[model samples]
Target: MQIDWVTVAAQIVNFLVLAWLLHRFLYGPITRAMERRENAIRTRIEEAEETREQAEARARELEQERAELNARREEILEEAREEARRLKDRLQQEARAEVDELREAWRAELDEDRNEFLAAMRTEAREGFRTLADDALRALADTTLTERMAEAFAARVGDLDEVDAERLRGAVRRGEGLVITLGSDVSGALRGTLTAAVRKAVGDEVEIDIPESSDDFTGIRLKAGGETLDWTLDAHLDRFADRLASAFPTEDARETQDDDANGGRGAGDSTLGDSHGGTAAGGKGQASDAREGAAGDG
Candidate 1:
């Protein structure tokens, strides 16, 4: 342990010098490099946060677009369905109207056919009855029947009204001359009787002309000017035909005949009956009486 104060001071100076060099060269450079690295890391973190927020905003926009598209699709589908329903209703209505029109046309055709058939049947029946009656009358006719008819004609002339008598007288004065038409020739005695009756009714100077027997009719017709007196079997048969026609009238005529019947009007009167010397009812009775009397005399 000798005294070493100088050696201690030299060692303290060396240690101080070494500390200063290490601080200047190592500690100062390391601190600056660490601060730069920290700043770069903070910038990178801020960029990442901004990118994430942008991505979230884009996702929200895409979701909204998808929702709008879905709504549009639903609306389109609903519109299509409504249009289809409307079209179906219109088609069904048109089809029903066409079917109704066809049915109505068929019904009208059937009605027309039915009316035609009925009219044909009526015409055939009327003609057949007329033919049969004509044959029966021809078979029953005889000379005696002709004489009785002539007698009936003479009686009818005697029963003429004043108006008819005056008309005949006027026609004779005008020189039209009376014409007596007969269905068949009568005996001389019957002719004379008819002639006497005509002279008694009119003036004896009145000319009476009797033509040859005509096959066109089966009755007696007396013509003077425009007036004619018919007392023919054909006239009686025409009244009967009128009655038959009224009984079996066509659809249109039946309605009118029914109306007239309800009004208490006779259906048997016709132009043929009017042409005779009496009303239809009176002529019918007289015709029946004449036939009976002729038959009894035969």
Candidate 2:
């Protein structure tokens, strides 16, 4: 085959024209559009990746906050429980102390009541014993003889102190003599013995007037000329008190010596009886108490 140069040249010219036309109409636009589409897809993929990362970070922060919140709740609950326990213990302690105080107070009140009741009972018993003694003495007087009593009484009246006899005389009329007052209850029974007691105290020649009073006044009242005497049970009690001068038993002899010394200082022993239940100077003892208290002031 002969080389077709003309034909080849002609064909090459035709292809060139067609290529230029395609580039202008189709290739150029297709290439530009494909490049723009690729850029848009790449931008979308980058935006999706950034959005995922943001979501992961947000999840981590939320989980950390939840853990802290849980811890705070646990601490608050523990504090509340501890406070409640402390309150309960304090209430219990106060209750126990109150109960103890009440018990002590009740016991003290009961003891006071018991002591008061016992004291009242003791006072009543003492009164009853005194009442019984009064009843017994009255019985003895009813059975004694009267005639023999008169003789004995006359003897006692003569022996009593002159001053004591004088106080008894005060009760008698001017012409009469001294007087002796016996208890109305025991007058008859004591009449003989008391007369004997007085006769033994004063001299035998003294006149006697024995009268009875309701109370215990086993004493003489004498009113001789102008002077008067009073010897009563109250006076005897006063004298008996003098005998027990000091409470100490060691002072017995000293008291007797003082009584004698004081007796020597005065004019004479006007007092009835000796220290052992003798007659006193009746009312003179009231004045002598001042002297005895001064002189025998041991």
Candidate 3:
């Protein structure tokens, strides 16, 4: 309680000195270390925040890439499916076309074979009939077939109508005289008879030539101007063959014959008559066959 100003002032001074020393040595260094540590920690925190932001951006980019990849895969699968569908359609069309081609080829081959067989049968039938007729005529009649044919021709010439006789006379007068072609040789008596008949039909001024030749047909053929007269055994056989064909006709032949019949044409008209009668009829005017007039004699 007693007042001591000097001592108290001295003590105050000492305390001040000690506080200054502590501040300079311990407090100053410790405070500066703490500030440095805080600054370092702050820098680390800022760096960590920046790294987190970068990672988030990378994740967003990855998610976008994944979506794009999924879309590309779906597109590729759809393209493959479309390609497969197109291939299937093309294959089916090709298969159908191939089958149709093969079917057509098979049908053509079958038709060709059938036609060949029918033609062969027809040839055989014609040959067989010719052989049979030759044998029968030789056995039944004491005369050769050629001689009988000539007799038939002479008879036909003698019985010619006025129109036919006039036409033959005109042909003989206008062109090269009448020429008679025979399949085989005839006796002098038969030749004389033929000559007389021709002379009676036409005038005696008309020249007549009878040429004997070994022809394929057993018949007589007369040529005057552009006109021809055919009376042959082959013609009779052809008529018989036509009748036989009518009895047993193929599908195509039957249809044709039916159409011809409906159009007022006879079956005989469509056939190849005795000794190329159809040809003579078309190329040169031909007289009617003598078989109808002298059937019994033949």
Candidate 4:
């Protein structure tokens, strides 16, 4: 433990120098490297925090977008429902209107048909009553007024115009001169009256061919060799029909002509030379031609 001051001082100096060297070469370098590593780690942590904040903000924005899309879908569904309701209401209204229109049309048609049927029934009833009354009057006249019947026939037939009256009178005056075939009955009282009227009207003597008795075929006949005028009930009927066809051309016209032929008037097809009578087929003229010379005697 003896004191060596010089050695002790030298050793202290050497220790100081060693410590400096270590700080410079080893400790100083280690500390500096550790400080650099800590600084890099802190910088990375700051970048990670910024990135996380950005992710959170992005997630909130996406939620808002999803909410807007749901709202848009609901609005579209509501619009579709409204459109469907409007379309349904329009179709129903149209169908109801069409049904009402059809019903109205059917009702009008039914009313027209009913009215026509009633009119036809009324006309038939009137015709029936007239026929009954006329038949009764004829029954009363047959016993009491045989001459009156002749007078009545002459009067009715005489009402024809001058031309028609002349034709009938001419046929009656020249009666028997035109007979080709002879039937069972030739003359009736009505036939005689017509013959007498014809002589008076046309100033010609008419000789009539009359059969013995009235039978199936009956009428006054006039014949002259080849030419013949059959005032038979049947022949006069056909001529009457042809004449009516030229005039009114109705079904009753045929029956009326038949009656005239049966009553002893020769109803051959008569032509009117004096009058300009139009036809019903042309639809240009009235039925006034019936009162003209075309239907003269018959």
Q: Evaluated with lDDT, which candidate comes out highest?
A: 3
- Alpha carbon lDDT of residue 139, candidate 2? 61
TM-score between candidate 2 and the true structure:
0.30
TM-score top scorer: 3
lDDT, candidate 3, at 77: 91
Taking every candidate in turn, the Cα RMSD to the unseen true structure, in Å, is 13.3, 18.6, 10.7, 18.1
- Compute the lDDT for candidate 3: 0.70
User: C-alpha displacement of 5 in model 2, angstroms?
Assistant: 28
User: What is each predicted model's overall lDDT from 0 to 1?
Assistant: 0.69, 0.53, 0.70, 0.52
Residue-by-residue lDDT tens digits, candidate 2, 73-153? 899899999999999999899999899788668666755665455445444443343344345444654332222223434
Off by over 4 Å in 2: 1-59, 128-298
User: Candidate 4 on 1-298: residue-level lDDT in tens?
Assistant: 6979999999999999999999999899999999888888887887788788888888888889989989998999999999999999999999999997887786667556654554454444434433454466668754322244335434543554576545555555555242223333233665566556645544555554433443333333333433333333343333333444345433344567778668856443444321124223323321222232233324
* lDDT, residue 35, model 1: 76
Clashing pairs in 3: 235-274
What are the per-residue Cα lDDT tens digits for candidate 1 across 1-298? 7868897888788778877877788777787777788877877777778888888898899899999989998999999999999999999999999997887786667557755655554556444544555466567763355676788788877887676678778878888888888877777787788878888898799888888888555667777877666665554444554555444455555557668768856654563356453333544465554444333433
For candidate 3, lDDT tens digit of each residue in 1-298?
A: 6969898999899999999999999899999999988988888888888888888888889989989989998999999999999999999999999997887787667657755655555556555654565577888876666666667777878888776677778888786689877766788888888788888888888788887675455567666877666665555445545555545566566667778789867554646354255334532312354434233332
**TM-scores of all candidate predictions against the true structure:** 0.40, 0.30, 0.48, 0.31
Model 3 spans with C-alpha error above 4 angstroms: 1-127, 183-192, 211-218, 233-298
